[model samples]
Each structure stands twice: as C-alpha cells, then as structure tokens.
Target: MLYRMVTPEHICPFGLKSLDLLHRQGFDVEDHQFKSRAETDAFMASEHVDTTPQIFIAGNRVGGYDDLRRYFHQPVADPNATSYQPVVAVFATALAMALAGTWATTGTLISVRSGEWFVAFSMCILAILKLQNLETFSNMFLGYDLFAQRVVRYAYVYPFGEAVSGVLMIAGGLFKWIAIPIALFIGGIGAISVFKAVYIDRRELKCACVGGSSKVPLGFVSLTENLMMVGMATWMAVR
Candidate 1:
C-alpha cells in the first residue's frame, strides 16, 4: 500500500491509525511524507482524491481513513448506532466497587441500604468519567440539556454537581442537607430535558451520561440517570 503522510501543521491522526491497522493486517506499506502543502495538493489533484492519508492496494485507490476501514471490513463511524456498551460497562464496574466497598466496611454486600450504596457509587463513577473529559462532556451535554442550551455553563457544572452528590450520598447520607437537594434538582432537570428532546421534540441524539465521548443513546439510559437521582433523593429524604 502507498500512503502520503502529512506535515506537523496538517497532522492526520487517523492516518497513523490506518497505517497501524494495515501493519497489523500483514500488509507491507510504502509510506511517503509530503514535504509541503503544495506537494500534497498536487498529489491529491493527480490522484483525484479529496483527503489523506489515502491508501492504494495493488493499484486500487482505497480512499481516505474511513474508506480504508471500509476496505478492511471494519466498523467506521456510524452516528446513528446507539451504543450502550460504555454506560453498561461503567455501571457494572461501579456496582462491583459498591459491593466491594460495602463488604469491606460492613462485611456484607446485602443490607437494608445496600441499594443506596450501589446507586451512590454508580453516580460517582459516571461523574468521574464525565470529569475526565469535561470539555467533551459539556459539548455532548449541550445537545439535549435544556439548561445547557440556555446558560451553556450548566453543561460544565453538571458533572461536578453529580460527583459531589454521589460522594455525599456514599457517606451514609450524612450530608443529606446538601446531597438530597442537588440530586433532586439535577435529576429533575435532566429528566425533563430528556423527555422534551427525545419524546416531545423527537430528535435522535447521543447521551452524555458516561461523558461526551460515549455513544450511549439519549433515551432510556439518560432518563434512568435522572430517575435514579430523583429516587435516591426521595429515599434520602424519607429516611
């Protein structure tokens, strides 16, 4: 395969990824680096291709990064594909940690309030994921979050609020004064925004529950996050 690599100014990340993919697939690649933008443009014009880094397999043009992926029968980008894998994995890990945490502290996983521990830990774990890429999370959140649409800053604050509430809840509801209110308030807004966007507005979108990079769909799991908060807050209030 022949590949024309770019300069530092026009770095193509997927070019590297595609090259690696080709290497793993046991294809001997002859890669060339374009010294200048003019050279690169000339190469593109000569080949009649729009983007790079392109691959040519046995004199057949394989197009750009995505086209290479397709030629290799690999899954490229599909925005419509609703992915629950990230959210499911995060929740599963959080549940395991909650069980381990409770067992470590109480010497038992099953208790009267074990559910609380699970929910608290789940929120904390999800919030931590969002906090990992706050900018990405906020950008994804702006898609469906009503407050984020209006205020914009709320998208950035949402993760912090979730993290605080989850941590407070994990402390055996000691800070019910603060935790309960945050849970209810955020959850309420989240649920309403999701309902309006997914049901009323009927738009297809990704959920920012696991963070902006996640592919979790904006419907069931999104609503569940909000409902979980409301439920946790209500339980805290009653108890």
Candidate 2:
C-alpha cells in the first residue's frame, strides 16, 4: 500500500516518483492520496511520519520514498555521499562559460582577459550559493575558517565579502583596488584554513565554498578554490 500527497498549490514530486518506482519494481500498489491538508496532517499524525509518499510492503511499513528505495536496494540521493561531483559540475559550467566569453570577445579561448572572467564568475556563483542561507553557511564555515572559529561574526561577513568583491573584480576599474586586496586577504586566510583543517589537523569536514548544502570535503578541491582566488587577486593587483 502507498499513501501519497497532492494539493492544489503544490504536489509532492517524490510522491509521484515513488509511484513510478513501485510500478517499475513490480510491486502491487494500493495507492492512496491526501485529498486535503487536514487529512494529510491527520494521516501523518496517525502514522507518526513527517512526510508522505510512504509505502507498505506486505503489511510492513516501508516508510517514505527514500526508505522505499532502500527497501528495493537502490541508492538513495544522499547528499553526504562524499563526492566532488557538485563542485565539478559548477566549475565545469564556469569553464564552459569562460571559454564561450573568450571566444566571443577575442575569437579564441586563449585570451588574457578570459582568465579573470573565469575566476570572477566562479567566485560570484559560489558566493551567491553561500549567501542563499547565511546562517547555514556560517555554521559550516566555522568548522574550518581559522578566523571564523575565533571570531564568529567573520563567518557571516565572509560570503558577502566574496560576493561584493567578486562582482567588483568583474567590473575592473577602481573597483579592482578594492577587489584585489579583499580577495588576497580572504583567499590567503581560506587556503591556510583549508590546508590546516584537512592536512594538518586531519579533520573530516564539509566545504562551505559552494554553500552549506554542499557535501564537498575539506581537501584539495576546497584548497584549490582558495588558491584560485589568491592567484586571480594577485594577477588583478599587478595588472
């Protein structure tokens, strides 16, 4: 048996996916839906479950969609899978955009200008993701940032600093003066923090570079992010 939810304003996507999965897995499903919010709440309360798309297999409570997946021996979309895939995807998109921009401007991807553009865009995107939920990012950041550990408020400020300076770096004028110094200071701090946390201290931590929801580890990938900022800042300062 399956109990799912659908509403006028929003339908649970997982509920639909659950039904599909059950059908594919050759389960005989007695599907049911919550006709209204009150009924949904009552059902959830009665079942003592927080979410819908719940399943019962042979009269045994199989739980939610993810739980059902586990029952079927399928890999659930677990975020803490400790893969660099998220950062890789973000960086790959940035690289593709950078190459396209370079080609558009100079008819080649080898343009001197494209390097900074790539760096700036990457930093900005990372910052935006972090800024989406400042509290969450700050908490994750405090796990490793040397200064943020000592001074908690620095965690809150870091993402905004990255975002504003990254945008300034892209603009490239008097703003470069502001952007360059900030990047160097922050990046230098970050690189050291990541190195000490992952290498020296041997801590297992999630990176806040791509934001709080990211499960990217505190290792070479995170160190590279900081190092890239430092390199970009140095180049901008000298040029």
Candidate 3:
C-alpha cells in the first residue's frame, strides 16, 4: 500500500516511483491518494508523519521516498556531490542550437559560420544563466575574477555585456564593430583571471562561467569559455 498526494496543481513524483517499484518487484499496489492539501495535512496528522509518499509492505510501514529507496537498496542522490552535468548540458544544448540555426540559415550543418554561431549561442545561454541570479553570479565572480575584484561593479555589468555582444554577433555585419570589441575586452579579462586563479595561484575553486551556483571547476572548461570568446572576436576582426 502507498499513500501519496495527487492534487490538481501538483502530482507527487515519488508516489509514481513507489507504484513503479511495487510493479517491478511483482507486488500488487494498493495506491491511496490525498487529492487536496487539506486531506494531505489531515492524513499526515492522523499518521503522525511529517512527509507523504508513505509506503507500506505486508502491513509494515516503509516511511517516505528515501526510506523506500533504502529498503530496496537504491543509491540516493547526494546534494553535495560535485557534478559536471549542468555545464555539459549547457554546452551540448548550445552546440545543438547553433548547428540547427546554421542549417536553417545556410542549409548546412557544417560551415565556417557554424563555429561562430556556436560561440555566440554559448555566450547568450551562459549570460542568461548568470542573469537568472545576478547577485549570486556577482558573488561568485568576485571570488576569482581580477577585474571584478578591482572594479566590483564590473561583476554586475559582465552578464549584460556578454548578452549584448552575443546578440550583436548573431546579427553580424555592422554589429561586428560593436560586438568584437566587447567580446575581446571581457573575454581577455576573464581568461586572465581564470588563468591566474587556477593555474598560477594553484587555487581550486568553482567556476562562475556557467553561473554563481554552478559546480563547474575553475579550470580548463572556464578558461576554454573565455578563450572561445576572444577567438571569436579575433576571427571576426580579421575577416
């Protein structure tokens, strides 16, 4: 037996998981749902439990989702574990978007423009990530960015600059004049900061490249992002 919340606005994911687990293990499930907040709270009070998605097997209470996972010997996610998944997802999506955009515009997946589009898309996506929580990004940036540390206000300005330059780069032609310099300046500063903090100073830190709350390492990936910006600006300038 499983009791879980299933309201009009929200369905409990763990409840679904519990049902699936019972089915997978060949145990027939008697699922009980609390359809509203009032019913859920009343049920919790009656049961003397603080959380829902409670599981019962053979009349024995198995507690909540995590408790059920432990009963089945499933590894639970550790919140503090460092993972590259977020940054990897960001880069992969940016590359895919750039390729799709290139194909739509020039009818080719592979082109000289593909690389340009990729970098611009990455900049736009990363800027949006930072802008999602500017205060957090600013705090993270101050940890290692030399320019941001000295100027302070530059930390707040960085995301907007990157966003504007990225949009302008995508527009091309006349916008290159504006975009190139902006990308070059910020990228140059970022590259130097990452290099000094990680390689020169030998400090192990989290990167602010993806966002303030990102667990991305303050090393190669961060440096690569800055270098890509500088390279894109230089490429556009020479062309």
- Name every residue pair that clashes in candidate 1: none
Over 4 Å off, model 1: 6-11, 35-39, 103-115, 125-159, 192-216
Please provide, for model 3 over 53-87, each residue's C-alpha lDDT reduced to its tens digit, 9 standing for 90 to 100.
99999999999888888899998777767778888
TM-score per prediction, in order, is 0.72, 0.81, 0.88
Who is ahead in lDDT, 2 or 3? 3
lDDT of 3 at 101: 90
Superposed by TM-score, candidate 3 places the C-alpha of residue 117 at a distance from the truth, in angstroms, of 0.7
- The number of the candidate with the highest lDDT is 3
Superposition error at 195 for model 1 (Å): 4.7
Q: Which parts of model 3 have CA positions greater than 4 angstroms off?
A: 8-10, 24-26, 35-48
Q: Judged by TM-score relative to the true structure, which candidate is superior, 2 or 3?
A: 3
Best by TM-score, which number?
3
29-78: candidate 2 lDDT, tens digit per residue? 88898878898999999989888878889899989988988998998886
lDDT (C-alpha) at residue 168 in model 2: 88
Worst 10-residue lDDT window, candidate 2: 169-178
User: Would you list the rank order by TM-score, best first?
Assistant: 3, 2, 1
